[model samples]
Structures are given as C-alpha cells and as structure tokens.
Target: MDEYRAVALGTSFMMLSTTSFIGMGDIVTKKSLDWVLSNPKIGNSLSILGRLMDDMKSHKFKQKRGHIASAVECYMKEYSATEEETIIELRKQVNKAWKDINEEWINLTTIPMPLRLRTESCTYQ
Candidate 1:
C-alpha cells in the first residue's frame, strides 16, 4: 500500500510539472505574439517608411514612386516637415512606441501570479 501511494504521488508530481512547463511556454509565446500584433498600424507605417528609405538610397525612387508617394502623403497628413524634420519626427515616434512596449513588458514581469489571479477573479466577480 505504501509503495502504491508513493508511485501515485510521483506520477501526480510528474504530471503537474509537465503541465506547468507546457503552460509557461504557451503563455510566453502568446504574450510575445500579442506584443507584436498589438500595433499593426504602427508596424505597417514603419515598414513603409523603411522601404521608402531603401528606395531613395538605391535611386529606385522612380520604380517605387507609388509607395514613396503614399508614404509622403501619410507623413504630410500626420506632420509638417522638411526631409530632416520628417526623419527626426519619425525617429521620435518610433522611440516613444518602443519605450511604451518596454514599459508594458516590465509590467508583465513584475506582476505576481497570485496577485494577477486575484485581480482577474475580482474582475469576474
């Protein structure tokens, strides 16, 4: 009977450990992807700007005029600027966005699981 109890306890512990490991991995991956997808518009805007920079540098400016024009139009719609001013403004916006994301990541790490659960439970209650 004692040996049977020992085996059952061992099995329960192993199962708990496996479940916890899988749950932790899934939670981390989900959070990472959530952060990536949270600001799709910002990412798209940055990507468009990066492409514009590439086009301008490579003198493919003519080939990519549509995208360049669209980017310019977006920039103009958003802010007033010369070329240098536009670059500085864009850099500032990107840096601010990154700072916000870093703060969110820090917040996620600092919350204890029990506190998080209690807060969530209160929300539902």
Candidate 2:
C-alpha cells in the first residue's frame, strides 16, 4: 500500500480522540500544544497499528458483507500477494508500528507522561 493512503486512513480514525485530548485542556502551553501538533508520528503509528489490526480481524467479514476493501485487500491487490502472505506482511507492519509507538513514548520527552500514556492506551481501544 502507498504510504499516504495508509497514513491517511489510519490518522483519520485517530483524529476525533486526539482532538478530544486537545479539547480536554491538558495541553495548555504553546510549546506542549505545538509539540502535539508537530510530532504526529506517534499518532500516525497508533492509527496504522489499529487500522491494520482491525483489517486483519474483520476483512473477511467485511468482504462478505460487500463492504469497502480494507488494507488487506489493498495490499494483496497492489502486490499480487496471497491472503496468507498479505497477512504476514501486514503483521510485520503492525509490529513496526508498535515499535514506533514505544520509541516515541520513550523519546518524546517534551510531552508529559500522562498525555503520552493516554495516546498509547487509546490504541488498544
């Protein structure tokens, strides 16, 4: 899958919750707010992880329902990969996204721990 499509689809799912956090008034300072706005990598990672995981779990059901194609379908079509191979590659992507999330959690020290925890925890939901 193209990077933009993957990132866009994933990030769209996260926008509401991320906005809610911003709306909560926790990120009050200009610097903290700027940090949140500028450093979107963690949010992107969460979105990618969530999206791929959901696709892995639900793509078959969705396909049967005639729903729109998921990342699995897209990946398979784009690369001529079998379903099993697509899943394996997607799993690798999911793993990488998790690493990105954890790395951001540890490295993005400018943002407070509570906010970072909220960002990380929301991925599981």
TM-scores of all predicted structures: 0.36, 0.83
lDDT, candidate 1, 1-125, per-residue tens = 23322332233322322233344443435444443335433333333334444423443354355432433334544666565665565566556655653454346543345433332232122
Cα deviation of 7 in candidate 1 (Å)?
58
Cα error, residue 12 of model 2, in Å, equals 3.1
Candidate 2 stretches greater than 4 Å from native: 3-10
User: lDDT value for candidate 1?
Assistant: 0.40
Pairing residues by index, what is the TM-score of model 1? Answer: 0.36
Model 1 ranges with Cα > 4 A deviation? 1-63, 68-72, 109-125
Question: Which residue pairs clash within candidate 1?
Answer: none
Candidate closest to the true structure, highest TM-score: 2
The 10 consecutive residues of candidate 1 with the worst lDDT sum are 116-125
